[model samples]
Target: MLAELKELFATWIAAVAAAVEAVMDRLASRRRVVLQEIDGDSFTARLGSVAKGAGLRPVSFRLTPHGRPEPPLSPQWRAALRSSVVEVQMRPDQVLFREVDFPKQAADFLDGMVRAQIDRLTPWAAGEAVYGLSPPQPGPHDRIVLMLAATARAKIQPLVDLAAGLGAASISGVVTVPADETAGTTIRLFNTRLAQAGRLAISIPRLLRGLLIGGGVAAAASFAVSAYLGARLDTELQDVQQRLNQRRAALRLNQGTSSAELLLTQRKRSSASSVMVLEALSRALPDSTYTTELRIEGDKMQVVGLTQDAPSLIRLLEQSPQFTRATFFAPTTRAAEDPGERFHIEAHITPYFGSGS
Candidate 1:
């Protein structure tokens, strides 16, 4: 159970970090616009300098939430259209887009759907963005598109409302250029202007045109995947917590278990015995050798010091009643930091039997 909790914590942390990184990536670029669906087959977008000269092309695809690409869309999704759609003309190195529209009801439905998806996107983003949609047609299969980030919505809303308030015709949909097409253009732009930092992620749609095309199986798969991932995450978290707790328990076991009163009684006796052993070992050491570092684990002692002769040090340790076996782990050596030789030795002290450790 403890192990599972720890794993859950780790996964949550990782997911949050991923979410933050994605948001930061967007904010790190100079593009701060997004496309949003307005009402049936109508949408709006903020075209930055890159798309200022580009044109739109017709394509079919599905729109999905960030991170979770498999979330289910409403069955009525097929009848919906983007609120903002645009018609573009491209030639040579120049491009231009003109907005278009669809039925009001369809456009509104699509706008709501897009909004819901953005709201649910994880690792929530701050600031506003715009989302533009493309005009779609009734096809033999369902179609979906990648919508813009919700963060971009806030930034674009005022302009959109202002345009609408001015009695301008509703915008018909927008499109995003594929990253592959933009390849390195952004990089060059950034290098040329080091002060520029904003997001430029494209929001291309992944349309699944046609209704009833794998409708049942695809829906089932989404449910299955969500359930499986949720369950697996829970199980993993439990396992990790359990392991951590077990490790903690094992470490505590090394101290041995006893009642509080008994533990206190044993500690006093153990302390005196340790002091006596150290004093006895110190007195027996050779006059020419000095103890530098001493460590005791159980009945084993590791002594590090320097001596005129290694053999003489061994003999002196052997003369102590508390010590039994003496071994040299490393030969005496001179250190660069200090102009003196150092020796490392190991020995086992005979614990007085029947006395509490």
Candidate 2:
């Protein structure tokens, strides 16, 4: 059981190593090509370029089997052919011919050529016409060596349409190089190995131009929005602050007015209290005793007098309703000639009454 597990582990390791090596080889290899091919019934219309060390070798070829007859060429076929670079490579049992042809000015002849190429390529190149062209370079004419992958018209056309829709100035040529360095390049290799053989280098100039235009518009919009919002916020903040200041100032003025009113009300109350105290004293004094001096100090009243009779005055004060618990100062008798005695007295007067209390 341990040996079996070891063998399985070894196999997995070998597979992993092989995959890593394959990826490294692809990255390091310099072999590449670009091709555009439209196959015919008896011949294939191909447009391609071989990438040399630095330059390009333009090539076009039509591969045909022996004993097979050549198809007639038409105007549309000629138009397609006008843009080709051809080369012939003969096989042991097959004849390979490559040529550029121009259809006669007549419409019928052009139509015939188009039909002929279409019929010939039907078995090998089915469905819609396939276009695969390569990036241009100079290289060997013996046979176009290819990377292992090929280009697909279905894939390449959308890219072409995309470039056209965006109003691209030009579309880069398609590549049909083989991923295998040893196998000679062919239509089949271009179909199968283009993803490996091809390099997709975008147009730096076009991209930069788009970015500059788009970026400027975006930046301007952002700045305008920021400035507008900032100004609006500033204005709102100022309005709120102004309102707060006004409210604060108004509050201070109101408080000062309220304080003055309170002071005036207190003074009026004190004056009324004085007037009432004097009135009460006048009403309560006895007939035998007339106050000679009346002094008011805060809430206390003092009375000094010379009465016709001191006993009568004392009795009158004690009986009065206004004075509470009166005390008489020491009385001073007059000289033998004088008529009456003098006395000083002090009394506390109630300032105001609440509920008869």
Top lDDT hit: 1
TM-score of each: 0.24, 0.24
Say what the RMSD of model 1 is.
27.3
**What stretches of model 1 exceed 4 Å from their correct place?**
1-260, 263-273, 335-340, 353-357
Model 2, stretches more than 4 Å misplaced? Answer: 1-256, 270-275, 308-321, 329-332, 335-338, 353-357
Report per-prediction Cα RMSD to one decimal. 27.3, 24.0
Per-residue CA lDDT of model 2 for 1-357, tens digit only, reads: 999987775565545544553465456632222323344312233333232223322334332333121343343433332322222121212212122233233323433343346435333333444422222223344323212122234434443433233222223432323333323434321122122212221233334446766999999999999999999999999999999999999998987879888787776555336556667766666555566787777656777766566665556555666566667766656656644566677777654444553
Indicate the residue-level lDDT of 32 in model 1: 23
Q: Model 1 residue 298 lDDT? A: 72
